[model samples]
Target: MDRFPEAFKRFEKVVAVEEIETFMQLRLAFGSWAGRKWVPTERQIEALNVEAARLRLEGAWRRETIVVRGKPHVRYRDVRTGRFIEKPF
Candidate 1:
């Protein structure tokens, strides 16, 4: 049985789920006719992941860090309410 969606092969959902920055780049690339037909190389995916990590570390898209039961955790922010939330299931 497969856990990932069928679109995962094209990285359509994979990139977005793994990293927002990568999704943004993927979106941009798909905006063009030529780019839409292109498949990203593994190196490109790796680079996107690295860029996403760099942005997160720099707080560009600040995910809130919270301490729960003496353990530190990070979560995405709800832009509408400015609240941190657990991973969306």
Candidate 2:
């Protein structure tokens, strides 16, 4: 499975998902050409799991450092909330 919607392939260029800056850009780029809904194949579902793991590393986690008792501790920030996660799930 591709990281982006299959509809994105219609464009002249396929960009990395990380380069997509906003949801509106995604909606405008792919939402208007509506079509039938479909289910993922078993193979595609496996690929989706890999893609999801990659996406988690890309966006689900952000790194931060904190001090505890004169020691530095690594932490993560929740991108949506702008708060320290301390340790991510």
lDDT values for all models: 0.43, 0.46
Return the lDDT, model 2, position 86.
54
What does each candidate score in C-alpha RMSD? 11.3, 9.9
Clashing pairs for model 1 are none
lDDT leader? 2
Measured by TM-score, the strongest candidate is 2
**How displaced is residue 81 in candidate 1, in Å?**
1.7
- Model 2, 56: alpha-carbon shift in Å? 13
Candidate 1 lDDT, 12-83, residue by residue in tens: 533443444443554354334225544465444334434444444222223567799999987766433456
Error of 2 at 89 (Å): 6.2
What C-alpha lDDT, on a 0 to 100 scale, does residue 48 get in candidate 2? 34
Error of 2 at 48 (Å): 17
